[model samples]
Target chain A: MNAATLARTRGSLVGRPRGAGHVLETLAAWALALLWLLPLVYAFWTAFHPTEYSTHFSLSAPWTFDNIVHAWHAAPFARYFVNTVILVTMVLAAQLVLVTLAAYAFARYTFPGRDVAFALVLVQLMIMPDVLIVENYRTISALGLKDTILAIGLPYMASAFGIFLLRQTFKTVPRELDEAARVEGCTPLQTLWKVYVPLARPTYLAYALVSVSYHWNNFLWPLIVTNSVETRPVTVGLQVFSATDQGIDWAIITAATLLSVAPLLLAFLLFQRQFVQSFMRAGIR
Target chain B: MTRSREWLHAWLLLLPACVLLVLFTHFPAVANLWHSFYSTPKGARPARFIGLDNYRALVDDPIFWQALQNNALYALGTIPLSIALALLMAVWVNGRIRGKGFLRLAFFTPTVLPMIAVANIWLFFYTPEYGLIEQVTKGLGFASHNWLGSKSTALACLMVVAVWKEAGFFMIFYVAALQAMSPQLAEAAAIEGASRWYFFRRVTFPLLMPTTLFVLVNAIINAFRLVDHVVVMTRGGPDNATSLLLYYIYEIGFRFWDPAYAAALTMVLLVVLGAVAIAQFVFLERRTHYQ
Candidate 1:
């Protein structure tokens, strides 16, 4: 459903009375919400304030960008950012192309072994590449692609979730559209590009957001595969930076944490509705 | 197009994804099983087929047992609480609650943040003597306690982080399901003079079963899959109390340089997840008939 329908549904469900119990419920919700936001809020506070004021809350505490500056300079975070950007972009680009073609094949064509192939593909959903880290590392090192951003993104390039979501979306396209496109002398790939792709924009958007966020946040695999600053993504870099003997500088640690997540957090805050809706759309399927 | 041509076209389109999936997903899975029967090759020594020696060792490995038990406890502790909190958050946000936008934003914020980053933030929160929790406890006249260092509270502390990180992500699904619900049921219940709790218990809860099941499967998978916070906050500290299956595998495979043992450990994880997958398929089949 679209935004308007969700809004209408919410509006229709909002006819509760303003009694004492209702007030208490509201208070409880607010309390829980505040509690949920506390760690993040504290991180922001610690990151912006001086180290002395990390655990000391004061309304008039001085705020500065020095922690962020120090955090930026303390590690090769700029390189890490570049590496993360390359990694997520490579993964999303490859996944979109691969998922699109695979989805189109499954959605429109009859082929031998299609069901078996589909089942095999769905195996990734249950047993993800994350769990098979040991063997995948051997394969990656065998290929001599160690300590590269490509190694970080390679296993995840063929995403089962993307393929599944896009396949479902493609199946919803009318056969008439496919026929019309083919009748116009379009090839199978052309039919996919012209007919199906344009209609599944929302699904593409949802899948892209989910994919980007997942790759951007993925740590363990990247941690295992990549070795150098040039290859480490933001998550791994942040880990290495913090896990080093930095002597527990909470300000710089929190600042580095914030810096690593700033891009995604900013994106979420900017597109709050789209972010929530995209996650909902992605998860529902 | 002819049938052969159609098949060829589909194969051509499917070729890339299938190849990659085989190389990465399917191949590694089979290889994990194959390697588990062998021994890890040290320098100047080749791996020899050991025929379940790794499995035998795993049976005798206390760390393996602890990791398994910890994972079970982690899943049992976190799943129900997160699911419950998710339902509560969904109901509150879906209703015409005051500041609905703020509540929704607050709840869903953690979902978007990188778990590693949030785990680092939590690491700070759990630090002794001067951390936020300690500060609050001390301010309230309670003795200071090492939340993450002590064995008894370490896993529980990590579980709290897991719940905090995941409950919001799960809430969105419940919200989607709640919105899809027909308002007529609620209207009918109201006309029947049913209390809100009674109506929720009798009608809303049952209708949300599919969503609950769906979230339950996802939550279960996440419980097994996610060890980021564990790696960040605890590193299975205080005598392996927080070591998860995957984390243990990482230690064996990477830290200790033992691939064969890790493979055997991975087989256990794979088996657990395989069972979950089969259950999901069965539930999904039943759910289709339910609709």
Candidate 2:
């Protein structure tokens, strides 16, 4: 105990002794941060500097916002921005109802084939609808929801991840709470509404945030389902904007790229801690 | 109400999602497996069943071989580097860092951004001239080079970008796992004259085993699932060097409009994913049993 106290006292004076391993580890960490920031750094440099100055990073170089104006004038990013918001909201709204009801069932019921049915739904998690584009396309074409926001949102409405997450949350609610509500002469549905749904509020919020971010970044499904610029999401539009055969204009492309990610970036900046916590609580890696 | 009625209502609630999953996911996977065996002539109605022909054809197909090699290389390259880097970042952020929140936000922001957006940014970074890399290289008097335009370097560049985008997301998981661990263990080790490296490797790392395994499986899966950057940034171009397995499947299924061949290739992918699933369960099962 005395030795422990002595070490604790000296710990602040002499920092953790330098080691080959720690040196390597710190270098590796900085390397990773650099790697993640490489594109952003490049983009920032290009965005600030002119075309001639973009190639050479002299400290006395000139910089301008010509790229931003160029990119802004090239497309109606505002419309794409609104479309993404609508798509995320539409999908999340439908998912809450479908996943909540499905979760309540799995959590509360002891039905035949419950396990198998739940597993079936979860296959969507592994083999996403985007992979089955040929079939999904046929389905969308048949529904006549093609080239519309509804089509972009439809396949994602019944989310397996939401169902699984909600089920886990619902199961944590104590049995006695449900029993008390039922004994108060409430119906089964009424008990669920009063006791269970309210209890699972945090899980609901976490799932909604995850679902919203997911749909906001979703690309391939929206790409295939929508053709017209009027209905396209940010991802599809960005792809088209950047893929000109003449090759990308680095400064303007970075500006456009930054514009595309601005919303989620702002939201995440505002709720960075909560966003990190949500992933932790969700047990997602 | 009664127990039986409650059960019925439960099924009723589950019915809609179950049906949709069945049609879109489960049924399609099964149908894809079936379709892999048949031949549908272009512009014809009836299809002829040819068992093993498609799979055999895939064996001889050079692009299939290239794609398989690329994906295996991709999984091999990205998983260990990113996971190790993620562990490092987590350990650092878990330490007494002054700007942990800001650093975490910077690390994680790319993941929330659409891949296409990131691809565009990286496109500028990999630009033949006037991009940051070329600028830096040329400033130092080295010859400026195209990072993604060449077949030799494109996949490596893609792997680097991929590790960048994903490492933070993985780091967040490890940080949570590390934070949830009691500080007592590390403190005890410090008193015993144990170095920080020893403490981390011997005590902290062992405690984080379950999380490491979890992250490993996820990182492996993401290695396969995410080739969007490849598709957008490189288009698997320059002699198909960056032609990853899934993108090749996309090309076959959507661009080439040959769903049968794509189905066969997807079967191969399913087999690969199944192997990963087995590793996760088997490794975890053995660890638990030993414990």
Candidate 3:
């Protein structure tokens, strides 16, 4: 080989080491990923197969939907699913409207005590309704919303994180858009609805995904507030179903676990890219 | 006239959110502090102002102290490990890896699944004998360990679960941060004969400190906030070994029906979270960046 060709080949070897170490690292990564996924895989396995096969990995184990059928009959899963769907939808809807109005005020109009009001709003970021369960429970009951789906969604309806995120997104919208809408005879609310809201659609989407995921998975407050099957969300419902009093049937519990998580999991699988990108865009770690 | 009208409109817009915020977060926070000083009313007894009695009770309560210590240890253990593992995961996935999508999905799946539901599955993993963990250890000729049963291992078992659940979520953030980084930094480091380890240690880590702090804050809050797994898997059991602060507070507030003492416990949580919130604000305000 010529000197220049020799140098080029040598440089490639110097910079890029395709050695056993790289291979080992890749294997280690894959191993850990597999390990990370093992629990869910096991859940699916146990849920599909017989109870005897739950702890054992048997290739000969016959698959059946018996566990799922038993689990479904064992509890009001369909009702729980409905309650969860309604809870998340109610919470998300309320949050959108409230945060939109509040975010608009914060983003555009500067009224008296705006700074103080904003500071007060930010206080919710630290002391969430989840943390103040004792008193909030009292407040919910006082409002006579006890054991209701409304109570589960009420405290979180005004999300500080949602307001903060939307305001940030709103602040980035150009003055020209708002001004152009105003010049076109739109009211302030009209300008927000038509110009600002549309411009911040991506932010809205991000916040919605984050909100939905959070409330859907939220447990403690719902566990406290909702007592009856009529109002209990899936998280609470699953806990009640799988409690130790039922004697820990792994197959049935796994089936119910799969059932409870299936909607969100299915959505995540289908829209994995958006779910991840929304989280990144939403700036929530 | 228009200016006053504008002010009215702004207040009108802010009303609903502000009212809900006050009712849920602000009012309850203050009320929790206020009520902690009083005696919780029993059936026929009215609540009486017993100044510092509840705090005194909290101080004397061994379970409270145990919960506090366990929580401190839990936070300390889970935070650094998760954050470090997250950074490591991000680095691996961001590089020349095959099946990046599958790896990312695997890492992130737990975040999407509810902790309560997943804890039930992990509960099976930690089950004593003929359980997944036991089966593995037995196959390896080791003793069948009660991963979540024995007092010595229960908290650690919960910590492992928390770390597994959180590290992946944090990885997404780190991944985002790493991707946003200019690739030229790595090229320059490689040109300077910097080993990958050395480069990550000296260059990548320092640049990612802000994200690290953000993730750290989140991990801290979550350490306190998320006791759902504890509720499911352990119930602070085998003598409250796995009882976290929040779980204890829940027991005190709800199960035991001692809202006053629970309020006291909550004050402790609030104080810690408040400090964290302040730190976050200070850090964000500084907007620390690197060259």
Candidate with maximal lDDT = 1
TM-score of the first chain in candidate 2 relative to the native first chain: 0.87
Query: TM-score of each model's B chain?
Result: 0.99, 0.95, 0.96
Q: List the residue pairs that clash in candidate 2.
A: none
| lDDT string, candidate 2, B12-42, tens digits | 8988777777767777678788888987567
- Candidate models: Cα lDDT each: 0.92, 0.78, 0.89
lDDT of 1 at A253: 94
Arrange candidates by lDDT, descending. 1, 3, 2
- Models sorted by DockQ, best on top: 1, 3, 2
What tier of docking accuracy does candidate 2 attain? acceptable
Instruction: Report RMSD (Å) for each prediction in the order shown.
Output: 2.1, 3.5, 3.7
Evaluation by DockQ, superior candidate among 1 and 3: 1
lDDT by residue (tens digit), candidate 3, A44-114:
99999998888878799999999999999899999999999999999999999999999999989967899
Model 2 bad stretches (over 4 Å) = A1-35, A48-50, A58-65, A245-248, B44-46, B287-291
lDDT of 1 by residue, B201-264 (tens): 8888899998899899999999999889988998998899999999999999999999999999
Weakest ten-residue segment in model 3 chain B by summed lDDT = B282-291
Across B1-291, the per-residue lDDT of candidate 3 in tens digits comes to 288888999999999998999999999999999999999999999999999999999899999999999999999999999998898899777776678898899999899989998899999888888678888889889977888888999999999999999988999888899777665676677678887678778877888888888888889989999999999998998799999999999998899999999999999999999999999988887874422
Q: Look at candidate 3 and give me any clashing residue pairs.
A: none
Cand. 3 TM to true fold: 0.95
